[model samples]
Target chain A: MKKYFLPSLKLTLVTIILCSICYPLLIALIAKLAPGRGDGEKVMVNGKVVGYANVGQRFSDDKYFWGRPSAVDYNSAGSGGSNKGPSNADYLKTVADRIDSFLVHNPQVKKEEIPAELVTASGSGLDPHISPKSARVQIKRIAAIRKLNEDQLVTLVQQYTEKPLLGLLGPEKINVLKLNIALDNLK
Target chain B: MNTEMIGIIATFLITLILAFPLGKYIAKVFKGERTVTDFLLPFERLIYRFCGIDPNKEMNWKQHIIALLSINMIWFVYALFVLLFQGNLPLNPDGNPNMTPDLAFNTDISFLVNCNLQHYSGETGATYLSQMIVITFLQFVTAATGIAAVVVLFRAFAGKTTEKLGNFFVYFTQTLTRILIPLAIVIATLLAFNGTPNSFAGKDSLVTVQGDSVQVSRGPAAAMIAIKHLGTNGGGWYGANSCHPLENPNYFTNMLEMFAQVVLPIALVFAMGFFIQRRKLAYVIFGVMTLGMLTFMIPNIISETAGNPAIANMHIADAAAMEGKEVRLGVTASAYWQVVTTIISTGSINSMHDSAMPMSGAMMLLGMMTNCFYGGVGVGILNYFVFLIIAVFISGLMVGRTPEFMGRKIEAREMKIASLIALLHPFIILAGTALSSYILVHFPDAGWAVKPSAWLNNPGSHGFSEMLYEYTSSAANNGSGFEGLSDNNIFWNVSTGFVLILGRYLPIIGPVAIAGLQASKKYIPEAGGTLKTDTATFGIMTYAVIMIVAALAFFPALTLGPLAEFFNLK
Candidate 1:
């Protein structure tokens, strides 16, 4: 037991230095060369930082396209989901409320047309993007409120939609923050 | 057919190709045979001399376990102290406050046992100092502890009528140096290159076009994430885990993280075969594990991609189970990652498990509950060893002979230990779940400051699943959560802490003790009547035992949770 102590201590010290200190420091240095310089990429509008291109933002106004509901209230510092299972009454009520509110705002769209992503709180409270279908669902509401031509807003949504990687990996998603910025930029 | 499918296939093929060489190298290092990394011999010797450890000394199983447990206990105390006082410590750029005592206890035990069941958000809950010292440091050492224990068992298997297994200290250090550290460095460098943050900065504030200010947290995340996956310790640097874009930047990094979590566990299977010179037996074990993994993975992927029927009823277009999943990973990768993480006990999530289709949720739960489908680093193999003993005992009994495994008798004492370890898994999980359920159901208004309603974000069948999943994950030593349970309180922390300790140590102790006892017995030659454990028939029997045990103990609980949820969705 005595013999085991020194070796264990020495090894732990060496490992702490190697794994916890030097290794992270080296990786931090390398991260400097990547996009966003190890900080997330900032979406810029009119020479000001709008938000991270990858992180979702809160947009409650009728004039702007809304992102997914955030469990953390779009607080990137504490990202997470509501973690509510679908069968839970509270979760179902929350979804129903979201659906009711959506129908009231966009009376043209039926209750069934409201995408799940629009009603459900995302796993990462800061989901930067929404499915293209979710983005399209909000087009009528935004165009009605902003007094923009429906075709123009539809084109704008299409312009901002990013395709799945390698044309086969994830779903087509529109970055909510980016799309909202584009919405503001629109004439 | 599609690029996503091609990418998944490519990932599996690459992992298989790499595991064989890695397995061979691991065997050589543990055997002290000459190969690469010999240049570090001086450094190894210096470490031994400085620490006053005699590398030549061989320990019996009892002494090996004593050494392993003592070191772990020291680490646990150290981690608990560091975590409790982290707010006052230096290098805390974020100034994250000290954890409550209950949370500190849970986090420390979780990491020490290689469970990595995080109750607190990483950005706000842990300081940089705590993340580095308590979390990342334990990621390396705890993984090494499991590897070292398994290597000792391998020595026991290889030796003929030997009392000595091997030096635990030597195996522990060598595993860290030769296997874990090098792999972690490579993966860490790659992750950083792919845009994962590795900084000491606090949260960055950004203003949106809508004039809203947001705080984006940054830290030394890449290095921790690399080992978190490679070491099969799935605690994430951020609360979002791999679901966070910076944590898993692209599809490439996502694939890499999945491969990193799986490769070592698979390699360890091959390493066992190489060590015991029982390649056929290793192949049989590997085949069973792969078969189990595929059965779970295929169904999960299909169910997730099929989209939720409930959501489809709402006329949601592009309904490919996109909730709680990143657009970059989509359904296939997310489902694949769920199975990989659960089966291997990596627990890092590319998608939120709570939002998964009900059947997919069941598959993840089953993976952890069974825990032998290529489990965490060294521990997965250890858990499988228990099942092997049960299979041997049952098979021998059926043939009207005393159970003989590798020329050693499976006596009453060995059976008692193995049975205890096997039964303990379901007992802890079920009892804990039952107790939590009773508290939530019978005492909804008990006024414990946290109401039963507050414990679950979603009520009914899914709520029941959240509680069951928590205990199952805890007892399996697989740290993934259903994500909705408010489990940071005293009840959760204390309960899961006990379950984590028992779940981790008992299985470990049972397997090594059995192997040690077997090693010390007289060598008996193989005869015509001896059970051929290496045969395909025995492999099928082992698989049957694993499923039967899991089904008998967990089927009812599963029915209440994921199974009930599945039919409800239908």
Candidate 2:
């Protein structure tokens, strides 16, 4: 066994080390070069940063759009799906409850306008955006609360909406925080 | 009747048929007889010179196993340190204060063992940079170790007694260098190009939605996605798994990722056939594996197309509306990816099995339960070899003649070794599952027991499925979960980790040793009485023995889980 070629062993090991080092360095370089945009300087209200509008948070009010169910009491570290099945009675019940609660809050809104993602939590609870359709459905309630026209609210949702990547990666979505912050800024 | 089921069967059959000719081509390409390795020989030599390692010193099977084991052990220790000291590391997004000792220990073992039962979302929670280091790099090595083992087994099939078994370190290095690294680089680039986030600079900008602000979390996603598929390692960077927009990004990337997951394992059967000089054998094995995948997947897609009665009752558009899945992949593509990844031993999931129809979920569980017949990187080929050996043995018995496999006489010693090799994995998986179930039953309030009774949740059949799924995931080393089970704590982590290691190595060591023993023995010539292993009759027998053994070993547990859940539904 020891009589085999020494050069082969040396070459194999060196190539491996080089390859191993290459991946991390390349990733770092790409990350540095791309430097994907941040949620942008945090928004502040009354001197304290309220929150970035890029992640999901609970909006318990009857008139607000309800996001999906959370697994971790809204604990960011606990972001996860309920891991419940479609046939799960508990899961079904929660969906019904969310829909019912939404209806109660905005009695005039039709069911079809509600986006499934709005009522169903994205697999990760930290889904910062809701489908544009979901945002559109809740426009009337938000407009009623803030004394803005529903059309004006729909226009705002359209402005904040993001298209899927290269026009096909995901559904069009509107960030909840940005929309809510804009609502607050409305005279 | 529905497109989802039609899509699944079509995909499974296509992948199955494709695997064969592909396996044959690969077999020819890698057959040591081919010029690829020879052409790459200079590169291998160049690498050796740079590392200052002697290529002349060839290790036997035992020596190779030792080197592989040593690498694994060292990584385990290294991983432990990373987990222990994670709080001091950087890149912790949620500023997760720190992992508690018990949690850290559980996670440490989980990642190192390659069970990687990730129930926590890393960005939102506190995992030290060190923990991430442990989870990612060690995981790469752990996966590579299995691939290395398969490479060794491939050598055994292709070798004569006089030929070297190949160097463990060399195989290990080549696999990481030639295969994993390049693959990761390309896939990551492609994924990033498709808009899967690959930055650690943080949030990609808060956007407004429906009069509210939301924070869209961002990170170095492309790097992780690359390894996730390459390693058959499936811990999602975030808790949403591949379903997350950032992780999977788009359908084109989604298609690429699914292909990335299966290409290695499919290529490996050809690797085996090429090395063994019997390209036909690889085809047969590939055929059987494809058939097994189709059997489970076709039925699943069909049943799922009928839609859940409960969902249908609720007037939800039950006709293939994959509610829990990303609309980009849809039900068809998601189901296809799910079955392909699970059946091929890649655990990256695009669909939620728990939310998939019960029968679909059962198929996923069964896919894992079969130990990824296309198994792990190297383990899959080794497993097929084991099946091949058994095929020869049983046929030899039927013919009242001694068994001969790949030119080696299979006598009592070889058979005993084969039996031990064959039985150890199932023993660990089924035994551990049984004990866990018993403990759950006896102490219904145990911390691990998420739902003790079978009445609620998915109840009865589905509830049992949750248990079965957990065991299947852990024991098979297929990391996708039943998800519904509350296996988040120490007991499961430690216990499942034990099974994971045993499930991976015992079968590995057993098969390799048998190969070594067989290599040393003399080959018996074929006689009129010689049992023919290549026939379809023997193939059916081989399949029966394997399935029977698996069924008999876990029937009781199956009864308790899926069957029990089935009855409870009634």
Candidate 3:
């Protein structure tokens, strides 16, 4: 017992120092060279911080492309999903409300045509990108509200759509925050 | 082929290729043989010296278990203390408050058992000090503890009627310094380079285009995320887990995280073969596990990709179940992750599981309940052995001969212990779920401080699943939740804490005890009529036994939760 105790205590201290202290410090030093410097990548617009490129932000206006619905109201402090199982009454109600609101905003689009991504709250509650179809579905509403050429707006959404990484992982997505920023910048 | 299919195939190929050599190396490490890591022996010797441990000293299974349990108990207390007083501790840059006693208890046991179930959100619940000292520290040691326990069993198998199984402290420390640490360092470095945060700073405030300012929490997340996956300790530094962009920066990192979680568990299977020189038996077990995994995985992928039928009926055109899933992962990768995480008991998620399609939820539950399908760290093999014993017993009975395994007779005592351990998993999960359901059903408005209504985000069958998944995850020591259960309360914390203890220790005790007893028994040579456990027929029989046990025990609760949800969608 004594033999095991003394060794166990010593090893615990060594591991704490190695894993809990030195290891993190070393990783932090490496992270200093990464994109965000271990802070999140901040999106800037005319010298003002306008959210993070990686995180999803809520965009409710018709003139801008909408992102996925957020479960935590896009609170970066508390990122999570609504965690509502599909059959959950509250979850069904929330999705129904989102669909109704989306239909009212995009009057040109039929109920069936609205992409599921637009109504469903994202896993992180901060999905920065919407599916390309979700982006395309909102184009007519954005074009009418912003008074831009429909073709040009369609081209803009295309320009913002990111292809799957190495064409073998994830899916095609359009960054709603970036697309909307570009919309505000348009002449 | 589509990118999703290509990605899935590539993941499997790469994992198999890497795990092969890793298994051989792990076998060498535990066997105390000459290897590439021999240069690090001086350092290992120094660890032994510092602890006043004689590396040459061997312990019986009793001493090994005692060493493993006592050290773990000490850690449990240490973690409990750190969690309770995290606000007062240093390195708390965010000034996160101390945890309530119940929350602390759950967190401690969760991590201690390698469950990593987070009742509280990471950023708010724990300080940086607690994350590093308690959570990350346990991630390393608990994983090492599991490997050590299995190494003892390996000794029992390899050596003929040996009284001593190896030195527990030696195996534990060496596993940390050699295998887990090296792998974690490389992965952590890659994660940091790929933009996971490794900072000491607090939340960064940012103004959105909508002109609303939001504060985003940042910390030394990369280091924690690395070990969390590598050790199969799945608690996330942030609440969102791998879905967080920083935790999983891009596609490459996603692949890396998935690989890390399964590599050790898979490699350990091969390690078993290499150590015992029974490569054929290992292959049979591996085949059974892979077949079981694919059977669950393929259906889940197809169901998720086919999109939700209910949503389809509503005339939604883009029907893939995108809710609670990252576009970066999509349906295929998310579904794949769901199976992999649950299968290995590495409960980290790349997406929200609660929002997954009903069938996917059922597959996840099945993975946890059966658990032996390439389980977590060393424990995976440990749980599988329980099934192996039952399979051997049944096969013996079928052939009208007494069963013997690895030269040891399989008798009443071994079978009783195996049966008890096997049955214990479903018993705890079902009983806990039933109790929680009764409380919710009978006392909707009863003042237990937290109302039953407050317990579930969804009502009815889906709600029942949320409760069931919680206890299942806890009892499996898997730690991934349905995420809809508001479980940071006294009832959940206390109940799951006990379940975690029972689930973790009993399985360990049962398996190790059986192996110990088997090792001590008289050796019997192979005869003409001796059943070849390495044969394909034995493998199929083992698979059948696992399925039968799981179906008989869990089918009813599963029917209520995910199955009902599945049919309802139709």
Candidate 4:
């Protein structure tokens, strides 16, 4: 024990310092080398800026698409989740309310067809993307309101689908605002 | 009762078999007793040649200390830079931008002190290029350091007036080369096999069930997931924790992760005992620790399986309220993981603990409070040894005999130091909880101003239980959270961060100093009546000491939280 005192203390202290300092610096350098846009480009139609596809916006109309549940009132400056767990009575009540609200707006839609994301908020309230299936499920109502054929809208949805990067990155998804703008331009 | 528990129990049994062989191999290598690990002899010679490190040359204690300190300081500075600039980093598929000044500072201290408390989510706020590099590197180094520390301490326990404290560089390299890296690869491979996502792309597109095109957020999730569990560092790549499905897809992966997180720390105890030639004592410590963890977990799992009666009363019968949990994980896995993670000081979670049944939540909190008993990696074993010494002494005094642990006389100073180390977290937790609650209720514009008496979400005895759980989590260096509390806010972020650092370091420094102090003293041979620590009698005393100390310190706060919540629920 007498022989090991200095070395153990010295070794333990040194190890903590190495971890706390050297590692983070190396990661920072690697991150600087990684590529991507700092912020996404704004979506616009007819010279009027609509919204950024990187952040979610409210879709109150019955004929439009829906996104995940949010804690923030769709305020990007204050994006958040309710942080409510599945067992919270409030969480259950809120989801039930959303079910009722969705039923009122899209009476043609069946109860089971309402996607889970529509009733539950994403971890981050700022999610700007929805499932392609979520969009397709609302296709009939959206196409009817915009006076567009179901097949044309399906084509439009395909146009909005962003595939996995290089064909093998992540699950494919569609940008919500872009799809909404395309709906506005439907003949 | 859940299949997930069955799967986890199986994984532990399998990993235990694997760990013994591996631990034996490691023990042999470190003991300087010749073994197959020396097969990497040529690589060692090559590394020594490449790095200009000479193994044949014996260095004094000071020289070894300098080398260790220099490498650590480098990591510290690296972590600081990353914390200051996490934005503009690559592979941030969600394009999370940057942490605020307060949050960045808080996170910096949190990791630097080894607190493992995460106040900010990685998915939303941008973590800069520098921050990612610094943070992950810090994680890798800290883990290596922990294993390295254990290696050095093991040599200390075995040495008889020997000047050698073991090779720092060799220990560090071996920790990374042999332990962490290989474990990570195997676990990562297993996770990938189980369908956990592993990718570098920023985004992907998927067709929804409803037929709309949607963009999915993507990044290097698999890499982070492996380390987060392996290191017992619970910081998540996605904010939803293991619930992100991609990070913890199914029960098989969840089981593997639980094993990966827990097995190392437990194995290290055996490794410690083996190195010191006190394998019997190690088994006793392991037995006591396992009993403590299981006591909390079995009941918590059963309560959760019972489902929420209130929901049943409403005729909702929501099927076990596996809301914050993965459907594949179900109640059993979530309950077991919650307990395992808390026991091991790994904060990673597959379910939102804040949403668990009150009794289950209380169990999770209790696990953290006992974290000082057997924490992460080296720290846990070190903590247990401290209590071992104290318990030996106390029982020795009761029997009117000398306390000798592993043939060394336990003296007054050693016992004092050990007691101080073991008691540090309990003090910090109780005080921190009271202080925070006071500030929340009394401070101007404090978040708790509108404290809803009845609608307080967690209600009755549980309200204070949430507070107690948070305090326990932070103070014990177990970062799993009670979801009912608003912890992401500034008050908690700041206060919890403060408590977390003290909670982690005080206990660490206390035991470390004791070990160092013990090392400098001459060993006294055991007499005929030495109070043996390996006996079952000693094991019960050690368990009682740990549990009683924790209960006494936390009883009032527990009353406020779980106790109150329980009464109200009734």
Best by lDDT: 3
> Per DockQ, what order, best first?
3, 1, 2, 4
lDDT of 4 by residue, B365-448 (tens): 778887744578777776776776778878988999877665556688878778787777788788877776666456635344
For DockQ, candidate 1 versus 2, the one ahead is 1
Q: A107-174 in candidate 3: lDDT tens per residue?
A: 99899888887888778887888877888888889888878898998888889888877876666777
Misplaced by over 4 Å in model 3 are: A1-3
Name the best candidate (by DockQ): 3
The weakest ten consecutive residues by lDDT in model 2 chain B span B203-212
The runs of at least 3 residues in candidate 2 whose Cα sits more than 4 Å from the true structure, single-residue gaps closed, are A1-21, A31-78, A102-120, A126-187, B1-52, B90-94, B124-128, B202-216, B319-323, B444-463, B525-530, B535-537, B566-570
Which 10 consecutive positions of candidate 4 chain B have the poorest summed lDDT?
B447-456
Can you give the DockQ of every candidate in the order shown? 0.49, 0.19, 0.70, 0.07
Q: B-chain TM-score, every candidate?
A: 0.99, 0.89, 0.99, 0.90
lDDT of 2 by residue, B1-570 (tens): 443334434444554455555455444533434534355677766666665556566666787766666556656665566565666676665455556555566666556555566645556543525433565565566666777677666666666664467676666666665567767888777776655665555543332323344445556667767777777777777677787656765556766777667767877776677667666766667667766767776877665555555544444323343445554455566767767767656676776676776667766766766664676667776766676677688777777777787767877876776777677767776777667667766877754434444312455556656766766777677778767666665566667767777766777787787777776666665576666665667667777776776677666766665544433331
Per residue, candidate 3 scores C-alpha lDDT tens digits across B157-185 of 88778788888988998888889988998
Off by over 4 Å in 1: A60-65, A103-114, A136-163, A179-187, B1-7
Best by TM-score: 3
Put the candidates in TM-score order, highest first.
3, 1, 2, 4
Root-mean-square deviation of Cα positions for candidate 1 versus the true structure, in angstroms: 2.5
Model 4 residue B138 lDDT? 54
How do the predictions measure up, each by TM-score?
Answer: 0.94, 0.81, 0.98, 0.76
